[model samples]
Target: MEDDKHSLGLRVIHWLMAIFIIGMLCSGLYMKSLPLSNEIKFNIYAIHKACGITILGLIIVRIFFRVFTYVPPLPANFSRFVINISKAVHFGLYSLMVLMPLSGYVMSSASGKQIKYFFHIPLLINQNKDLANTANELHSMLAYFIVLFIILHMLGALKHTFIGKQNIFKRMI
Candidate 1:
């Protein structure tokens, strides 16, 4: 039987999303590491916010396409445990992708900071300091998990490509 594959557009968007996510993660970590003032931190955060919002938009489109498109199934020989784990990881990734930016936006808005998307329109959410702090904490903690998952994801893809001799990497490329 012929191998099922992702559509070209889906593949392109997938890889682009991956790049944006990595960029956001790196910039976020760097911004956190800096000993800058709140204003400076906010400026850095604006960039992060822009990247994150872009990612959120891309993810929405990806999710829409996923629902409508005919995505290829995983290998039949794949174990149930592996399949379950994959589902859990995918769920986590999607949930975090949606929540992280929303949390950041809430944090900014609550602190009386404007959430600017690049040079585009600003996001103005109602202020709530208590909620903002909670979101901020969740965003920070989830970031560590994102980093770990990304590392594992990369390792898994490499294993599939090098050892399994599968075209798993090509699916996203």
Candidate 2:
């Protein structure tokens, strides 16, 4: 049935966010390991900040669309346990998606660093070392949780598609 599949717009946004989030996670880790004085590291940092800001904007758009859209329900055959776990994982993913970038922006802002949109337009904020340190810690903590949630989400979909014969992956595709 048509209702089983996510809307085309939702699917597109879902895939786009997936790609961007994965890239951000990878680059963020790589950026951290590199020496601060490295030119490549600075370039990566700029790209990371720009992408984080872009992701924040996309999250706003996603919330707006989610409000007006009909989200397809999980397959009926799944156990209540599975359903509840799925809901929790979805919630975790959404929460992390919003929080990660927000904390990044807050950290940057509190550190007196102006985050330029796409490495050009300046978005300014006041500086506070205390808040910057706090936000930075929170942002760092979130990275691990987001990775866990993403893995759970993917494994669930794969299990449903291949083991359970639910074809759940097709809903988003």
Candidate 3:
């Protein structure tokens, strides 16, 4: 198979997104482990919210570039099952990327917290206790799924890089 290349813009955004996501995940786990307190929880939530919004923006730009550019194709020797799994994984990643933040926004809005976007503006949604609770639960649950997906993703990438000896990892870099 030909060595697939990533566009400079895509590569930059991809790495930035990866760093942002990893940071957010760490912050989130830390926040979850902390005791509920106004000062500490509020600060962590603010940072988490900011990161989520930034990720949303970056994801939008990534999608636009993905639609316009030609990403490298999978290796020809790759089996159809492997190809199908890759497609499924990609779909899940994108879907979670979009949904996780939206769920968090809904949860924050429902709890009557000021949804600050990078300290730029405060967003408000209708205050409904039930809705907020539901969103919070969904967000929490999806977070676990996202964490699992990420682990699987990293394992797969490592397999391609070391075991499979494929260019999949290099193409992204």
Candidate 1 lDDT tens digits, 77-149: 7679867876777777777778877777777777667657756545476677887788789889888888877
Worst 10 residues of 3 by lDDT: 115-124
Ranking of all candidate structures by their lDDT, best first: 2, 3, 1
TM-score (all chains, Cα) for each model: 0.86, 0.93, 0.91
Give the least accurate 10-residue stretch of model 2, judged by summed lDDT: 116-125
Error of 1 at 164 (Å): 2.5
Better of 2 and 3 by TM-score: 2
Hey, what RMSD does candidate 3 come out at?
Answer: 1.9
The numbered model that scores best in lDDT is 2
For candidate 3, give the lDDT.
0.83
The RMSD of every model to the true structure, in order and in angstroms, is: 2.4, 1.7, 1.9
lDDT of 2 by residue, 31-138 (tens): 889997889997888789899988888888887777788888887888999999998998899899999998998898888776777455444567889999999899
Considering TM-score, which of the candidate structures 1 and 2 is the better prediction for this target?
2
Model 3 C-alpha lDDT per residue in residues 1-173, reported as the tens digit of each score: 33487677888998998898888878888988888864797798988997898888889998888889878788888999989988888778878888988898888887888767746545467788999999988988888888888887888888888999884787777
RMSD of 1: 2.4
